[model samples]
Target: MSNERAKILIVDDDAMNRVVLSDLLSDEYDIIEAKDGDEAIGILETTAKDITLVLLDMIMPGRDGLGVLEVMNEKGWIKGTPVVMISAETSTPQVERAFSLGVTDFIYRPFDQMVVQNRVRNTIGLYLKQMQLSELVTDKIYERTRNSDMLISILSHIVEFRNGESGQHVLHIKKITDILLRALLKRTKEYKITEEEIGTIATASSMHDIGKITIPDEILNKPGKLTKEEFDIMKQHSMNGAKMLDAIQFFKNEPLMKFAYDICRWHHERWDGRGYPDGLKGDEIPISAQVVSVADVYDALTSERCYKKAFSHEKALEMIRNNECGVFNPLLLECLGDVADTLPKELNDQRTSKLSDADFEKIARSIFESTENDTENIIYEQYLTEHKKSQFFASLQHGVTFEYTYEPSMLKLHARNAKALSFPTTMAEPENNSEFWTIFGRENWDEFAKLLHDPQLNNDSFSFNSEMLVKGKKCPCKIKVQQCWNRRDPENPELISVYGCVEFFK
Candidate 1:
């Protein structure tokens, strides 16, 4: 099974050709000889798993090399096995067919022994290396996922410890989130959600109420409804949790951490714009948070708390349906409806009565140990390698990306590798810089505003270039603008956000 001594199947009608190839490869690989395509197909059907490379002949008496390749392709046997075509034929169509049929390399007749040996060895080496690299990448992805899960579990347990609960609240939220997310992936095309992203969102759901750790025990475990001042103090947890993550250097730029921060800070936001520390309405809230919000609310309604008894599944669904909790994303509500019937059974299976003090302490210690170990540096390095290779980062390294609020406020001056555009780095509010407009000029701003303000203008998206005042000189800059809004509000389609980026002409 080792690639160094992998099996090679040499298909050639000519006895001398087969002998030469076998003689060349026999020392390095176990060789199999097939006189024609039929014999090759038979051997492959019988022992394809053992073969690593194929030296196929183009010219043969019956059912030639191309025919055998067609069979291999049909059987899905051509993927891992490298096929080399041995041919004297010069016809363009014949050669193209061999290549098209997934030939790895073409070795022409009157071949030098060294050339053939080198080609076979090199092809095998290249493919083996590729396979190894793919496996390494898969392992790295698994490691990242495991670390993320462990971190979230630790944080969730901490939240439970503070509230004096069994910690099953976070687990319940994760379960419901997974079901809802899976339903969303199956039912919607409006948002592009990948399987990996689903796992990240579900794991991050455990930290949706992580901010609750900041709230005083008296407020967190009130046993009665919180007073106005206590409630207000409790609401600050979202922002506090976000700021806490922001303080960690390694977590600042991680995508998973970013999702956790968003979920923590914005899960309270309502689709109707009534709920929040930020009053961010509808789609302004990230989907990561929206999904968790529904899950958290559902779990809260259905689970026993210090202040309230667990409600029946039907009653909980009724309350959510009537918007008794708060306005939720309509699409998410649809996802909830799709999975509602099965939730009770899922919850019953996952329910935990209580967590012993020792177990809670053990989990907390493991979390602290993990933090002390600084595993984030490993994840950060992996993320950096991948991020550096991305085209988006490459573009930012050469220029700046800017987003504007519907209120016409500058979101941020985003640039990677360096400050591609000059902005206030020390001022209390860099966005207040009047010179911000100077980079794009009035004409460019007018076009951008027109796109953002007018729903009909160029289908609400446009790209153009204009001369801008950069560093006290006129410079041409490319600008792209797109209109974004809260999709939950279809009645009023006003743009709530504008994403635009500028690049200096090279």
Candidate 2:
């Protein structure tokens, strides 16, 4: 591997410096030369493959190294390319600016060959190490992604399998979300969301209701009325969904997990603060939550559930229109109008449940006939909102089962669920011993220990024992504390972790 030639791009107007530097490192690397920043960018604009490390000079005539960096940032052609600033200008401000613009490291003028090689090697190695760590993390995430995708597919299947909605509810929601989010991007000039990000977000959105795994199939598939308490318990699904997402932190930045977490937690929240568990109102909710809210409600209203028949797109729009300012974001409601007719058609909502005025009133009348009626419903009178809770719950009744929540926390996971799940219990000894941890982890032991020591084992009950952790048999890799060895695999690369164990090739 050491014999492998690293590709180095040299961008400089200085012939002498380039010659000297190239002569020193050319044997160890395949040196690519560009006289100026514009030329360097032009080279990169075409087939500049495998060009890893860039030794960039600060001052050039037409477009300097800084200008090249600016172009690179704009194009975003490369993800984590390392550019080291090689310059005569060693002033504090200039060096600071270079570092600020994401330069990997700096090498000054009158630089020694040994020092230059060391800095170049250090930066390249570090950059390579970061790339490897990212790959490993990505590999771990990809494995989790595959697992999540299967789990979500199963949940989605459960919804359609029993409820008879086509196996495409989630697929449609994913598509609609993509369309609207892209439209919003175009309209609002929002952040640059990549295709990968969108794909992952859509995929993750599919599993937002996987917490229904914990819900009983009877209540989930029931074609009848759930008592108020049962309905409240049903609400816990959202929290359950969020809890499921939090359990596998390996998928943190994966868009689907993020979308799933948001939808699972806040899908039930009202635009007004009247929503349950956490009475989050309006924009205080996550934008992903808001987007899914619009998508989810629109799908549910137009599709049949067990308790009621589906409203036609026109009626669905009317309901949304009635909702106007309070229930749905008025702007999003307006956006809904743009896609209204085509959406159901696109989603292939062939089993559209036809409903009469009686059916509407059957749903609408629940609040009116019940003693729970207060000024709140009367205030939103024109809206005629039956139940945000019911809408979510009835989704299951229609076989549109999604994951849900009992409460949302400051971090967005349901604190009740996290606190409940995070509680540790002692693992029973198994012959293999690994199975004990494989099933129930050291976390469980720590929690049990905490509870043993303290009557109340709260979230903050256990202080992390760094030394004990280091000495543990699991020997889980901690590459950051020392250094990382890069792996070439993009999908699932192994990260070579260097521990703090003191050793050398003596």
Candidate 3:
């Protein structure tokens, strides 16, 4: 629609027909030619995003125009790029079939130059306007989403501040909920969730504990275990949170508000009907609430609080898997296990300082200074690349892997490896785990610690061979360790944690 010429793909088996169409439109538009459907599809596959319109012939040798249309439909290119059919086949069935396959217009054989140019111009113009409208709507939706997330974050932080929390709880819950939902989608289509819904649910999860704002400070931040009456009073936050949302008459019917209400009211409910506040069981609980419940419990366990010391990531996960905290949906528990290895790193990243909205805008402007109009396409392409990379790594991983956080002194093992080795999947304090000490003994631990701290050893990495006391017999193994450091303050580098693996010898 701008002064720049739009690119049009001309597909036909007949060389003369392709030349005629190209000559008619090449004055106003850039024309790309393809002799057959296969060639056209190849071009489209690589440059579909750049193509503005496709002039396709109905019949050709090997994968005709209709076949090309089918491929375009499958790949979702037809939605954004307009397709016009150029052929002599004007029968109703053939035309109807082409239309059904997403053909925009048909220019009959012996095409007049003026008629061909007009149709091409109209189709491209119409699609351009439609695309512009779609982008405007998308931008509006994103703006609204950002505003809602900001308000919810501010309100959630207020509640956390009042309750004496570290203020990262809401962010942790949101991230965990998103990870769990995506993992759940991979495992089953039972929930019928979309990428957009995953984001909405994660945003709504922040308000899950908003009802705590209504509670008295004494009961909310009790230093010790609450009395029976105080516990009963404490359980009312879920219902109170729901009631608060219900009081907002204007947004009562909104989907996001409804999600927030469901999560707030039912996150405390358990899968076995043993939980308080209405005792939802099994699938009776909403998926959003179910996900937030697991996230909330995991954060609660791993986070330090007034009443209890923080458990290690390994210990918290072990507790949930064993149903020590409470019963959870088996599928959700499996989803939790799937993301277990990445959770600690993801949460730690969240703990890092985040860019403010203005900072984000400044960075975005700088990145888009040369190609401001292509910002959306650039982001979409990056997302596709990252998604492919995630899938690639997920499939590529093998053997056992584990991570240890230094401050928390928690060690987490691959779930399958933990089960195979007869070791707890997660250990809060490895030194305190009798089974852990039994397998790798205190003497080996002392030697391992000394090696890790030795100045001569590499600061980032060290390896050693040791014998594990397995089944009252010693088995030789190799241990590899990689240290993670916090370099936020370059002058005072801090050791954050280590990730390592063990290879047992036969």
Candidate 4:
């Protein structure tokens, strides 16, 4: 009797009584009835799909309503299903007991027809409201959880950067997690996953190592086998991380939260249950932990720890596969094997090397040079060259082309091949366009620089971030790249190419 329509199940011994309920409610709700409490339990166990509410008789032959209530509580689905008890057995004790077992309401028999209709309608309305509120709360919490995960990742990168450890750890974990999550779904199809779910999972995975927050920096960066006590403290990070994530309600039931929880809680659990915290046996441990267990250990093994030199990737894989640590789900171990075959030497090499102050200084240098070149040929007579006042103007004649190659992983820009790249900040946001990124281009850009260096004829340096562009298009005179110096190029500088102009540097 369950469908898109509202479904209500009634359990009462009296046949004529069932007839009365069926006639009154059947028009608006899909209804099911059982002759006794035992039969009612049977129907619920067999086909309770999509049931919204239960109008249960409190007393019946064989099994009583309370007994059925106990079963529903065990099923865990009762939290989502509403139950209202109805019977002649509405003495104080019976009423008290039904409520204790989670019945939503109690109505004694010899009921008023109008009262019954009103109570049922009101109960469903309240149920609907609670469900809606729960969803809203869940969504809010999930967003916070996702943000928390992102925050953890950023913080972790900062820590690694301080230690001269580049973002190799973060990138490695992300790629490995993606592979494992996909492989598991393909193998078992345990849950229905969508693109959005994958996104949250990835975001939340950022916190898998959040427990490391509690570990002392010395021990964390020691790069060797942790002493027994130090290792013990380190082990607690998974538990600590899980607790941190658990504090947020949205993450309490989310898929990514589940993944994070596993990472934080069970990543240390052993296949043989000898690992630590709580040694859950293989398959007994959470699947998330099992997948990451392999990944974390693998990354740690291959990374250059202060205590231990980085192991060769080949050696690392061989050790994990050859050993019986039982750290990974056997299926995941095989998947890792497939990925290992293609893992690059470059990935290993990038374990160190992050942008430093020196790097930023070089960018500043370029800015200075670009500025100096513009004043070289500026006819102070034609225009008042407020040398510093004309900051946005590009010295195209001496403007040196900046060619930048971005490391797809770190997200920092390097510049070359473009003269006078400048980025100016705007206090006022764009009024009509969300396409502000258009300074780079609205269409196909193979690399980020193409778009950033791309010009927008509509806007000027004062209008937006002109930090990455030349002053303007080629001048009407078509001056040669070497012809001018110490002068701010006119509205149009000489064009070597559509995006090219002469430049100078300090």
Candidate 5:
């Protein structure tokens, strides 16, 4: 489509025909010649991705044009590469058959050079436009998918963080659910699940424990075993999570919402009619919920939690098979065994990779803007006000801007400043970060911490002078801080996070 010439492949047994066709369009296109179907098939196998169009001859020695078309169809090259039959065959049945086999156009024998050239040009142009449209659609779909995954990750991480579970628990559950569902598909057709349904179910698996957000922190993070009464309260999270999705009103009927509600409420159920909230027996539980249940239990057993040490991969698998955790669908249990060897490595890889603070904030901002709750709307407005102020201050000064959240203990540096200082854009647990401590020095950090903790200065904007190591050189800088708070409860405001900046001064 650009100035670069499109490559056209001409396949014919007659050398003269090839030369005639090549001479007709060689000025505007690069041409490749094949004397027979075998040679044409060989060229296509090696270079079909680059070849724009195929000028195939119907009657050729050793594999005819139709044979080549069949092969192309089998290899899936026919979809992207257009084929025009430049053949002597005149029968309607043969022409129809070639069209059925994916020939875009058919030219009769002794064709006019002008007609041939025009048809070839038009076909290439049409196919190019179609390909471009396909690519654009694919890109849009990919972007939507990425944003959906980011939001899901953010929501799941919030629940996991609050529940004191490993950060990778949601990811592990997602990956394991996907593997098991795919394996189940191969093992039987009892569920009649489509590939698209598999994806939806796997994605919804991340929200299986979303209800835990409603649980009290004391019960959610208790280091000791929960009492029966406390455990019963904890188990209510499933129903609570379902209620959250059910209350969304607008998207209640959407497939993802339905899947999320099912998984949230039913993932904790068991196969033997002994599981909670409404003990669904066997297939009474949706396959989506069943698969996530297995994934959740497997991840819980193999991952170290606040109350228990991690079991080995083998031990976890043994426990599941022995029904020590809970009874599961037999098909899913077998699916688990099928993927047992890959689970440990997959989970380990997930542990090492985490979302950056900038990404988390971006997702948080998006979620805040979209939430329907009045309380969240108030917080969102407050966040927007602070964010605008931060942006204005950053624009007015040549300094490093940063934000620190108290509960998660994350410090995020401005993108440019982070690059200039050779520091991570986001550092979790700044007090424990060696790089942060090295830059600010422990004494300076302690003073800063003390200042932030002082009740009298809690809501005040303040500044202090400190020496910081910048690129191995000590520089005196003035640091300004602003404390952010959730004023939803006017009488009892809560400190949420802090925003600050550092400017080097002589």
Candidate 6:
């Protein structure tokens, strides 16, 4: 059914019957006519997918409404398309059969126009509402799944980046786990895994080693076997990973969170029960944990570690099959074997696709610098906007506004309101702070210089009436100045600039 109008099929042997219904509904719906049950069946067989409602006259010359209803049921069109039985016959048996055969409503000959219109409107509204609700649910599921995936991707990258592993480590685990899960689903009915659950397992597998972020680099990348105490500290990552996710209030009771937490905290647990962080034997381990544990082990074996070179794909599979890593679910092991030949190809592709550390760092830094620059540009733009507004307002005041750079000893006259305060704009200003002071009376210049240099008065500013010398003539003037501090290195205590307004003291 379209958002504009629903499609309605009007079926009757008599032309007048079809004409009456079409006249009533053609304004609100698209009307298609079938003169008999056979014609209706032909239309339904060809176009039933889009047809929203069927108006079937019960008593027809041949293959009447009951027969059409039976055909619709057999064709499985009854679920999506609702049917209404039109009857001139007042018989009870035919109407009962029509209802049992899934007629949505019934209308008699000499139809009440209002009753017919209301029933058709209500039936279409109900179906549309149900369809809309189903679509809303599907969209919500997709949005939640996407958000979950993005969150895991970001967090897993942090772990892999900190651990100095290739960025593809998590990706490889996810791929292997997906292959293993699908193979398991096909090989046996023992695991009641659905397509949705398979996706969850694959996504959660990427976070199996997320706890490694908490492990110190020295211990994590040690080239030799860890000391017992160091190994204990290393093992805490699983619990640490779980605790980290648990702290996120939004993930509370979310199934993905549970799957991720289980994978993180228990991927190390073994079938025979010799693993760390609460070892559970056999099926006591979560299915998600079991699947990811296998994926993590395969990747670890085939990936280069500080302590050992990467094993060959064949050797890695052989080691797992031989239970060299630890005991695993026999069912999963069988599934792994079924797909083992393809695993090397998948892993080879991942390895070939891996970004070098230098390349990864360069790319990561580019992204960070771009974002930082964008933020800084926005702040600088806002500062300029406010500064312009302040300058505009300051321009309206009756004085000469100037900004002085302390280090370079340059003065920029922003506005001049009096002839007594005139300075030559084309001429170079004073070359340094000492030369700048020569424009004022010696005693007043010395006092102002002391104020500029005072540590305690670094940010504090003052305004006073003083005698200023212009063209070697002393005149009373008032000045206000405030020091500007360097924002980048605040502790350096270098005065960056000073802004002031000056006018005649009278």
lDDT of each: 0.73, 0.59, 0.78, 0.57, 0.81, 0.75
| Candidate maximizing lDDT | 5
**Residue runs of model 2 more than 4 Å from their true location after superposition:** 1-3, 12-14, 34-47, 60-64, 74-80, 169-311, 314-506
Q: Please give, for residues 61-151, the per-residue lDDT of candidate 3 as tens digits.
A: 8999889999999999998789999889978998998999999999999899888988988998898888889999999888756656554
* Model 3 / residue 49 / CA error / Å: 9.0
Rank order (by lDDT, best first): 5, 3, 6, 1, 2, 4
lDDT of 1 by residue, 48-143 (tens): 988989999988888999999999999999986889999888899988888899998889889888889999999999998998999999998886
Please, what's the RMSD in Å of model 5?
10.3
Residue-level lDDT of model 2, residues 342-411, one tens digit each, is 7866677433232233434443343234334453244123222212222323333211112211121001
Name model 4 segments beyond 4 Å from true: 1-3, 154-506
* TM-score for each predicted model, relative to the true structure: 0.62, 0.44, 0.50, 0.39, 0.61, 0.58
Model 6, span 364-458: residue lDDT tens: 33222334465434333323322332433334456666555554455655322323456532112454345446656568867776787787877
CA-RMSD of model 4: 18.5
Cα-based lDDT at residue 254, candidate 6 = 80
Poorest stretch of ten by lDDT in candidate 5: 383-392
lDDT of 5 by residue, 393-445 (tens): 53446788777887878776765576788766667788888988988899998
The deviation in Å at residue 97 for candidate 5 is 6.1
Estimate the overall C-alpha local distance difference test score of candidate 4: 0.57
- Off-target runs (Cα >4 Å) in candidate 6 are 1-9, 22-52, 58-81, 88-103, 178-196, 217-230, 321-323, 329-335, 346-506
lDDT score for candidate 3 against the true structure: 0.78
- Candidate 6 has its poorest 10 consecutive residues by lDDT at 361-370
For candidate 2, the per-residue lDDT at 227 reads 83
Distance from true location, Cα of 222 in model 1, Å:
3.7
